[model samples]
Target chain A: MDSVNPSSKYKDTLSLIIFIVVVLTAPLWGKFIGAGYPDLLQKFAIFGLFAIGYNILFGLTGYLSFGHAVFLGIGSYTAAWSFKLLTMNPVPAVIFAVLLSGIFAAAIGYVSLKRTGIYFAILTLAFAQMGYNLAYSVLTPITNGETGLRVLRDDPRVLDNALGVQIDGSPVGNFFGIEMTGYSGYYFCAIMLILGFYLAMRVFRSPFGMKLIAIKSNQTRMEYTGYNPRPYLLAAFVISGMYAGLAGALMVIVDPLAGAERMQWTASGEVVLMTILGGVGTLIGPLIGAVVIKYFENIFSAINESGLHATFSFLPEWLENIAVTIVSPFVGDGWHMTLGVLFMIVIIFMPGGIMEAIRRLTAWVKRMRG
Target chain B: MEDNYVLEISGVNKTFGGLKALSDINLKVKQGTTHAIIGPNGAGKSTLLNTCIAKLVPDSGSIMFAGQDLTDGMTPHGINQLGVSRVFQTPEIFPELSLLNNVMIPALAKRDGAFKFDLFKWLRNENQLQDEAMHYLDDLGLADSSDIRAGSLSRGDKRRLEMAMCLIQHPKLLLLDEPTAGMARHDTNRTIELLKKIKEGGMTKIIIEHDMHVVFSLADHISVLAQGAIIAEGKPDDIKGHPKVREAYLGTAEL
Candidate 1:
């Protein structure tokens, strides 16, 4: 077995506590940023969980998988089916989503992992694209095509029926009679995010994680060191896929919809951006990345010309108009442009991402203090 | 089935297109001995070592390492797990990891087999393994710099780090492909001393070296190769005096 210094163990515990406090208090702090809404908060937790898992494979093993969304899609579909056929409860839905997505991830990973580098990435991308097409077209019966898979009022929820749970209206995801909606949903997802983050931390500090880093640093050296890289890579891929599945399951748990678009390549690309934007290899980087991207997509994209105009009202009328015109392309539907520019800046200046910037800032502070 | 030889390579032949890399190469490395293979560039020294580690599959012939047939579809890690390890010419250490991690990783691999899930176990709790890793770092005179990234080390230090990596595994057959490829005179001498220290442990080593001084100092037995075939094999002094070796390898340069 491999071992680290004891001081780091204390550091890990401290970081976990800080992380828990921050996540649990998101709604309170979120109010100041105009992001106190339960739906957006729920998204932050869900995507944060997704990115944390992606970091395991992409961050540690350096396997750039462009097909993770398939697992997410699989998770959503599995959860929706569980809701429709089995129960209205989130527990069984989440379990089925994780297991099914893990199986899919295993099969896909086994095929894609045969090739490394760009080929491996392309292979994963191809598998996800294929899955998206199937879910949209041929597999429409199960996936429900463009309509998406959701629990219907008339669908037989055998478990709920057997448990004598009363459903007066449309089915809502419930945890023992407590509806998974609004604050309850956000808290549920937040708890999962915290658990996922803890698991990711465990992976980062574990010996297996060290080997994964070793694989990233020098795969040839790792093989020569008597380690078979395939098993490790596959395990990471499956673990991350399960994470994506959990996130997908949570998406339905909050709203109960499974769309083929969730499996699209762009969705896959989003998680990749989230991982890179936060910090590729660092723990908590992916969550920050996910939150940042989701924040931009939700909050920043909602900004309109009037909002920009209001902010720039202090300027002269013509200058305010010009400022709004210049900034308009970077907000609303064009928020991607802002994200693109931010990504470029981060890549060029702080290639390690926001976490790296934070690290450097702290280091600078320490240097000044000394 | 079992003999004093730790490694027995017989009638091994490897070819790339029409070119023969190793043609009917036959050599036996005894247990607890430092055997050196000295040859000019492209003389199949690295090729033979790669074949031994299953990096390159030979077109023909068999390599038996302590009753295990290496040529019979054994993977590199499988060979390594069977106490066979190799040091590359470029010093293949995990560049981004700390020097201590560079040492500890192989030790973990050796102890934990090819794969183990130990996801929740704290690496800080593995006190014995960490101590052993620290001891090896101390052995290589790198204890003070164990926390530094392996990539930031100088070329000679990287070589020493690689040696520490291999040594911690305590491999029965350690194949080194030019262990002192790019080093100053003093660094080369220091590596020779390190190898000599390990030689006291009675671990078998096959060193492929270009430097005559390193080969002569450490190798109890020497094999001279020219054009993918062994021209001479004997005690180090006898290998130095061989006419074919002097002409093919030395090329009129006095050793």
Candidate 2:
């Protein structure tokens, strides 16, 4: 393990500048583009936050937690409840969601961190399943059972009532003189994503983060160094869980519905795919991966075989039929299968994910230049 | 000599099911001196180091460090916080981390306590830790490779880097397991010279070694173990002449 040098400092600064520029322009691009695209972008941003958070633990510490969706689900459920019961203000809802998720993560992490490697992952998966079951069966009144929780129109916003006008079904809550919907909602999620990204970047550079890498490399050596691996693992797990919570809260803010499916194992698996696809341990890779996967899910899933056939009409009839037949399995209902194949290809051929491939290409180019 | 005895072990016994790995091992390590523990295979040299560092709990024994009773089931982190650090037989550096971050980790752990939740703070701005890491890396001739990933280093360089990592904590006691086990003769000599420099810098070290050259060149005190029991303990020259030590080595020729 080495420390940051002056040269890498310049690279870091340049990357940060590029990141800021892209973030600043994302909303502008979103506003000008198709409405559905912006929504997809928002989903991408939220899931990116989720995946980045997951990577902090899984990527850094080498703990492959299988129950991370519990945190996200908890965040969504808590945020929805806060909005429906306490207030409609998104800030409080997000804060409540994060706090609740953090507490949940801490408790689960405490028990799970007692085990290492596969056992720790199993513990997390079991806890997540427990949470999922609870949300479906026992927590029916709060979670609203299979139908899930929705923000009712009659939910009282005391702050709005104090102003003497009933603001029912209106997305017009002024938070410090700013609307909390539309552009405001997007900005809110984007800001949170940025903050989460920044925090993760800091952790990547920190000494504690180095300890995590060491623990990942060799647990026995870490023990001999006088460091207990459990606490560090637990802390990473909680931090990652909290990030998932924030993502869940953002999910509800973008669309105020908390479904039981949000906490499902598949949801957890999706984030794992995103992290691995993007490049685990690389700061920007998860976000890019999240965008790519969500883009395919939303856009590719909508394109039917007929639609593809019509689009490719310029080709010869028989060739177009063959192309459509070949491509049909990759679109619509087969999108997940396509993703699975893509994941396998990337894993086998480009084990470091897209970022590493790009890094290697750039290094190769530099060598050629030399 | 009173303050110099940083590590005191007595009646330390470790058993795995029906077999005893270590029995009644008593030892004292003086500050800034290199104390070497040598034994043939299965002599429990690794087990003793593990017990001292709290990786494995001794069944019945006491380990005292700097006036603190560390044998009361403290965690490895707890013992590390008490100013003790160890290096493995193989290089255990973080393969992905830069060399500087590796050294900085233990240094920060030593300075900032075992665990910290400074989530919102930037760690690189902690000038004190950066300075200390740099100082240690410079001492071990690894400052030039501070930015390189530790796994990319040559074997000799990796060993030096690991040493730098252990030293950065300014530990009162350092435990090294086979510091020259897999090195070439030149690399072993380099490691010996590094150990000599470390000792000259007033760092107390306990080394578990098989290479007699490294042991003889660096150890001020030597302890010989045979079949999990210490058979000889004295100055290096005295242990070298012990018939029991010779017999133990001769009996374990297959090792």
lDDT: which candidate is best? 1
Q: Give the range where candidate 1 chain A is weakest over 10 consecutive residues by summed lDDT.
A: A1-10
What DockQ results for candidate 1? 0.76
Q: After superposition, how far is residue B228 of candidate 1 from its true place, in Å?
A: 1.1
lDDT of 2 by residue, A1-370 (tens): 1122322456657777787667757866655544334566678679989998998898888899999999999999988877666666678888988999999999999999888878987898898889899999989988898998887777765654555544445443334446556666667777888888778877876666767777887676676566767788889998999999999988887678898888988888888899989898777888878978987787778989899999889999999999999999988988998899989999999887878888889999999999
Global lDDT of model 1: 0.91
lDDT, model 2: 0.81
Q: Candidate 1: which pairs clash?
A: A3-B123, A4-B123, A4-B124
Which docking category, incorrect, acceptable, medium or high, applies to candidate 1?
Answer: medium
TM-score of each: 0.96, 0.90
TM-score of chain B taken alone, candidate 2: 0.91
Worst 10 residues of 2 chain B by lDDT: B246-255
Q: Residues A169-229, candidate 1, lDDT per residue (tens digit)?
A: 8888999878999989999899999999989888888898888999999999888889999
